[model samples]
Target: MADLDGDFESAESGASETYPQQCSALRKNGHVMLKGHACKIVEMSTSKTGKHGHAKVHLTGIDIFSGSKHEDICPSTHNMDVPNVCRKEYQLNNIDDGYMSLMDENGEQREDLKVPANDLGREITKKFDNGETFNVTVLKAVGNEAVIGIKCQTS
Candidate 1:
């Protein structure tokens, strides 16, 4: 007999990560779950019904945090997972060992995010080294979050 004693309860077990949405109702620039990634729909088109099949909706999306592309096709009447995505801004506080310290408007601090290893990271580092105060935009979805943008604080 196989053992099954491991506790697999997740911290967000009580929260629903995604909601069901009809494929045909999803629009471009909306949020979607493609291949297990939370993405923003960049392009969408519906193809006419085939010989004995229903109409298909083709989707092309970009992963909001990772900037990766994902695509999929499904019958227009089928249901698809639409992730609950949220964006929040925080004041940049510090950076150390590739991790960043950020403070929210209420002064709550968060230090769990890593500096992206892409062009954005380089830009962030440069701005920080130059002593430019800025706000970081963090995108959260599907139990994951990341710093997606930065904006200088204006007078």
Candidate 2:
């Protein structure tokens, strides 16, 4: 139907763009999608050609949020999808009921978000004091937001 086609076209146009990258192009400390999980590549190795006649790439990474190790192997020429990730800094405003209220540099308050489960997050949870300013890293990707790290702002 014409209406269905129009709606499909609009949805397709609104989708985010992703580029295919060769396994060899991936590097340590880079982000990659492995097994449908966004992971941070912590280690990578390339193997010489085997009887199959292709260099193989082995990657080991941890889930960005869950911290679970993920490992995979593929031919060096294989292509993979890379996720769009962005980091922004926010100031800590308050913490209550396991949620953090943050404000950007422009002083705009963001919706209270759950604290991350990393070491930095734990530190914030135990040491938060109202009115203390902190520099916090917010990881944004694919409509997800998370606090990755936090450091007290030095006077």
Candidate 3:
């Protein structure tokens, strides 16, 4: 019985650190889960063609945290958290063909750059948005892409 208790603790501890396996339970009704390495709200659009023709919103975010981005269509009446807490300034050191080197705030150098445009579901990939800082939610070093869920910071 002691061994069983120990195993239960270990399993619960591990589960605590990772994201929930089932994505359906994360968001509320009318909201669909966008998938990536780490998913975020990409876009949410709605039309008034139905019987109610209710208002809708288009939400677009990145899942660079999970190395992906996705789009979802939901009613515009919903509210969501636009989490940008992972912002740490990084410097563009070098660009080799398609790859770019990024130096983070800690001065840690990371290579293996893949353009955000190459992301599977990412639709918009403008040239590093002028003066916009990008956060590397997931990078390419661990068999993922160079970056994911990159967006410009406001204030």
Q: Which segments of candidate 3 are over 4 A away from where they belong?
A: 1-17, 21-25, 28-37, 41-89, 118-155
Q: lDDT, candidate 2, residue 3?
A: 57
Each model's TM-score, in the order given?
A: 0.88, 0.81, 0.34
Best by TM-score: 1
Model 3: per-residue Cα lDDT over 1-155, one tens digit each:
35554434323323222222222223322223343233454444445546866455444556544434566554545433332223344565555665667787688997765545554324223434343455544432112343444444456
lDDT (Cα, tens digit) per residue for candidate 1, span 41-119:
9999999999999999999999987789999999999999999888999998899999999999999998999888998
Model 2: per-residue lDDT, tens digit, 26-130? 999998888877889999999999986799999998877677998999899999877788888987777777787888888899866888767877788766754
Better of 1 and 2 by lDDT: 1
Candidate 3 minimal-lDDT segment of 10 residues: 15-24
Who wins the lDDT comparison? 1
The count of residue-pair clashes in candidate 1 stands at 0
Question: TM-score of predicted model 1?
Answer: 0.88
Q: How far is candidate 3 from the true structure (C-alpha RMSD, Å)?
A: 9.6
- The parts of candidate 2 lying over 4 Å away from their true place are 4-18, 117-119
2 or 3, greater by TM-score: 2
What TM-score, to 2 decimals, does candidate 3 have? 0.34
> How are the candidates ranked when ordered by TM-score, highest leading?
1, 2, 3
